[model samples]
Target: MSVDPEIHWPIPPKGGWTADDLDRLPNLPPHTELIDGSLVFLSPQTLFHSRAVSFFEWQLYHQAPEDLEVIREFTIDIDRRNRPEPDVIVVGETGCPDLNETRLPAASVLLAIEVVSEDSVERDREVKPAKYARAGIPHFWRVENDNGRAVIYVFEREPATGSYTSTGIFHDRLKVTRPFPIDLDLTQITAKRRVE
Candidate 1:
């Protein structure tokens, strides 16, 4: 199913959203960036997805280099037309300050990690990859919890026209160490959490 045109279409806002405009929004319901100009309701995270994100965050927090900074579900303004909040972002400590006011620049982000949920799998797997690539974000990781695995897609080279050209898929219980050096044990990361 196509996203509602009114919701997902990349239209130019009359005057664009400023930091003040973003702050004025009420905190009742959470919203997400959609193709820069529009905002859409963020779907609630499922138990499985939530657990996975927690696990990944814990691992990354302890294993990642001390100099690197990691943020969970933070928005980065890629351009005037695209703003996506990936599940996680790892960047150098210098680029992002300790304030929650501004949107991080895409160029400063070393990697963008997206944890897929049932409702957002298509967008995370397909739409976001191309978007991040076009924004020159360098690397994108897609974690599929339904199958209890993660697919690491590296955009080493940019495509001339469409999507990223140089892509690599790593499976079969491997360690991830490109964007940031970490010996991620996939099996441990995907271990089933006890159901409540």
Candidate 2:
């Protein structure tokens, strides 16, 4: 018989846990998010989730212009009550937070990407995109695993209507020109590592 370690969940302050509370809260699970003033704990990541996030992060960091930066698993300050962390974010250099910062203002985010996990399908597919568009983020990508292959659903915000318009869906490769030109081989996401 084995004993599991104890986990402590913080009590929310007066109204509820604010975006700022995430940084101050003690013993909260790693990758804890705030959605509508409530705590949203993430389930353990799967190999596909981790690989897909790494694939995009690496590709974006190498291809993005000097004015933009790629970040992984960092929260965006959507509102006082919602600070959701996207799997990968491309942010303009001017809006990049300092070394000590834990989150970025959604206004500065050029693109937000979420790699779907079994537990986060609804939030990633629906809720987060709506909020990201409302916050004026220019682009969003939701990556889903279809029978062990990655399918990328790309969306760009319509400036006139302030809603996301489906740009394109990439199955084997992702090539997009808006925000910046990026072309990546989706198969690289699961390639075996070479021992050098």
Candidate 3:
């Protein structure tokens, strides 16, 4: 009798995941926040997405009041399980830190920006806003690159419900006229593309 030695079943990895488990994963791909004990994979941002971020960053870097410091793509740890990397963050002078750390304390973040990618739209629009609001981070901005245009969503107040209720959307032609102390020209700001 000949045995079918070629037939075999692969065993899956064992056990649940924790934050420590996440730390063990390979550093090649970027990871994101999940509920209590899971890992979420972050999709890479597209060229358009990168452009929008750069444009906004340039404007804020030069135009924001000298007292406010702007940081890019830094993780803000809201809890043991929720750490989000906003595209651009405005932190008060006292709260800003040296460049050695990977995470920022929630209290230090004054404004958080998330540039929407196709793969992350739902997570950006729904999951993260709720998380930020719960953390009592005062301001949150969502930059959506959809249909060859950019739209900005500014949440003024912390959301009482699961998502931001008080919001403003600025299109390409309109100026971002609110969020005092930082005057931004939305049209000119979003027009600059990232150089290759």
Q: How do these models rank on lDDT, best leading?
A: 2, 3, 1
Best by TM-score: 2
Distance (Å) between predicted and true CA of 2, model 1?
26
* Superior candidate under lDDT, 2 versus 3: 2
Cand. 1 TM to true fold: 0.75
Q: Put down candidate 2 lDDT per residue, 13-105, tens digits, no spaces.
A: 788889989988877888999998999999999999999999999999999999899999999999999999999999998777488888999
When sorted by TM-score, best at the front, the candidate numbers are 2, 3, 1
Residue 170 lDDT, candidate 1, scale 0-100: 56
Judging by TM-score, tell me the better candidate of 1 and 2.
2
* Candidate 3 lDDT, 1-196, residue by residue in tens: 8768875532214443434444455542564554444566677778778777887677788867788888887777777676777888888776666766666777787788988888887878888888887887788898887676777888865445534555677775434444445555566543654699
Top candidate, metric lDDT: 2
Global lDDT of each candidate: 0.67, 0.92, 0.70
Query: TM-score for every candidate vs. truth?
Result: 0.75, 0.93, 0.76
